[model samples]
Target: MSMRSPYPDVEIPEVSLTEFLFADGFGDRADAPAFLDGTTGDQLTFTEFHGLVEKIAGGLAARGIGKGDVVALFAPNLPQWAALFHGILRANATVTSANSMYTGGELAHQLTDSGATTLITVSPFLDRALAGATEAGLSADAVLTIDKAEGHDSLADLVSSGAPAPELTTTADDTAVLPYSSGTTGLAKGVILTHRNLVANLLQVHVMGSVTDQTKIMAFLPFFHIYGMTVMMNQGLHTRATVVTMPKFDLEQFLSITQKYAVDRLYIAPPVAVALAKHPIVDSYDLSCVKTIFSGAAPLDGELGRAVAKRLNCTVLQGYGMTELSPVSHCMPDDRGDLDLNSSGFALPNIECKLVDPESGKEVGVGERGELWVKGPNVMVGYLNNSDATDATKDADGYLHTGDIAVVDDEGVYSIVDRVKELIKYKGYQVPPAELEALLLTHDKIADTAVIGVKDAEGEEVPKAFVVKQASGADLTEDDVMAFVAEKVAPHKKVRVVEFIEQIPKSASGKILRKDLRARETEQA
Candidate 1:
């Protein structure tokens, strides 16, 4: 049986995302800062932001980029990134946001796959951007920069075109953004999220968060990820909050910015939570202004969440979603801080979820674990140009098979336990790697860790841990590491193998890159 959200459904506007965001025209908050650069202290007021959006739209239209055309945005989080994003949409074009950490070849895949005719990026990333454009069969003329470059048109050049903004022709059903994702298991494929998906997620999240125009939200997560695109950037715009942008994460800088801006709401990944909880530099800053720290992207350990909340004297919340769900489906409400920090709270309004036993293909009752399937307005239409992949993930009934195993309590709160593909099996017993990884993180000597299923000499699959030890823990032995986890977990879930690494490989969004670790093991084999 599919379970509905405990919260009442919120009305999803039929207009485009831009229409839904800018319809009221800023009202009395026109002069308020919409985006603030945390590094340089530069800002764009709501009025200026809207004007830049129009200018960017006009510039894009002048370049023959309009309805159905796709433009690639390959830049870091900046106030201009937000403007250019809206500008592309305003011109009735779709935006394919590429990961900032992507290599030239990696970016070429997205450009060619999304059929992006133009690429926009900053001057510093010109090398990779130009290389990607060239590899994707695009001329240098197709490349533009956010800042001035020797031979390229800049965002300023776009605004100087003086062309009138095109009329809004996009509807809620039109594709708004194409963010690539590997989904449950596979190589990355473009996820087709429509205007309705974006708008619905914004409205759905609005009912669960405490953000307001007066709230100062810190956005360090990459805007290219759907989590930041919807939960941070667009949500800030929707609520008229001032978002402080960080191009990247730096420990001391993050703390300083939080202090400088008196930022109240922080949206981060679990890795950032680790730094907040364990880093000594955090003690030097005054984070009293911070009221909440919301974590997503990967499962946040409950103990880590509690540590950060206690140390910062603030509320810490977690959410569960994937790229296909506009990246937000379940989250703890601001007022519900009393709930378990481990659970991802209730489903957002208008969502229906079912937990089905993977092997049995039967829906599980509350408290039983199964793969989570979601249906909602925020769910993606499908994978772009990959019907087989789409059909494999999303069923005929509109339910998206998330492939993440989860359990629900009688209260309807959901806790994501593990990914179906990532779970380790030991002697016919299922072992969730996340549970072991989370347990390992609680050890003082372990800075970071990743757990994966590796075959032993007997050809039996067993759990192995790749650990990054703290600087002070150089003398800590592998036996000590295994023993630490062994004492807490069942025999089937023991970390049978341990390898000390300098760092655990992670994606920009903070998910453990288990495939990379597995490849390393394969190379050795």
Candidate 2:
């Protein structure tokens, strides 16, 4: 892989995962809370966290777990989650994070795919994880429990054994993490992210002014998801920031945490942004403490930015990335678009981005729309055990072709103008649904919007949109909305058709479910 960047001063760490964070900056930091488990008063300091990692590492070592082994972490954002992550890395093993909300079927597929031997999970999910493991043909050696370990060993107890850090030499290039991603058009595939990949993103995110030791970050996003895993958990540790975690995202709990910790940073999705911009409950808490509020997993509306900025008086920054790139490709710079105003901003300092024509691999003109291509050390090594998909995504020159259609000007500001596959193709021309969707969100009257293409009788496709009106019982006709989009976009880019619904379907990661919406259209037809 090419190891050069536009900015020559970019630095890459030459240390192991344990050494990079725990060994380097961990001096007399035991007293400070390393993690605050919001579900309970369980807080671990740097010493405690490090101690637990050693114990878990020792336990895994005793069980013959060694270098290059894959471990499954099947739980939510809790103390044990982080412990398992570090412990697996400490044992020179790879960690594959699984979404806690997944059913046994989903869990089975990932477990089978990653070829995991050991699964560390919470007590509440032990039965499900075990059932999933058995079904997936995993001969489980250990099921490290999170809380109650009546029949199993508690993760805390394993770490509290007072076991010291084990003697081991590891490399940053050794694969440390295995995150999964559903590509632009396929079932989910495991992503191979080395310590270098994760650490690179951590370093880039740090250099991009992500957060610091002084920043109080509210961790409501699910750690199982890459966005939450990298930003909330790993970034917090790398930066020595206080992570105020939530077991789950409750609007009241979210605001309470904000007021409780005087949170300086928050990484949210579009739904939470909607709540912040419009939810009446937000007014009760003082959100002025937040210096930076980031939105990912879904595209954010700059118009919502205007509304939220008016209320919070903070920088609302957004960037576009997926699990394939350790989940973050950019952080809206404090200077980009007048300081986190609009646009996803330029690629990270060490990251290279180019706009490429979807059909042809040719570069597009500056400010012209094309599928965005990303290349950086932060990009995942490849999809785990799926070389075909990996080869297709990452080109010969190391560029990870992001499926998003974007426009980049000379200023380095990139806007997610449309999606390559997600866009609506009218006749032969392309229609940026995001443009129409953003316009719809700006209307104080409309709440939710999703645009998808449905096949016509002539075997062609037409743009059809489904809307979720904000006000209850509001009478909105398709023609009225069509007129709104037609007035804003080109003749072919017009909505053409609209259907009002109670809600718009979205993924747990916060992306709009265009496929689900298309399925709805199929059902209707």
Best by lDDT: 1
For model 2 the TM-score comes to 0.79
lDDT of 2 by residue, 1-525 (tens): 122233434688887767878877566555777788665657888777877788888878777787868889988787668877898889878888887766565678788898888788888887778778888886544677777757776776666656554577679888887776665545567888878888788787776674767777788787877888888898888878777788778899888878876888888876678788898999999887988788777667688877886788887888778788987886676544364455887677688787888887678877688888888888888888788988988889888887889877665767887776564444433455665687677766688888777766744457777888877538777887888776645455677778888889889998998878877887999
For 1-525, candidate 1 gives per-residue lDDT tens digits of 899999999999899999999988999889999999999999999999999999999999999999999999999999999999999999999999998866686689899999999999998889889888999999999999999998999999999999999889999999999998767655568999999999999999999988999999999888998988999899999999999999988989999999999999999877688789998999999999999999887778899899999999999999988889998999999999999998999999999999999999999999999999999999999999999989999998999998888999999999988767675545433466776787888999899999898988845678899999998898999999988877655465689999999999999999998989999999999
TM-score of 1: 0.83
Candidate 1: lDDT over CA atoms? 0.90
lDDT of each: 0.90, 0.76
Q: After superposition, how far is residue 110 of candidate 1 from its true place, in Å?
A: 0.4
For TM-score, the strongest prediction is 1
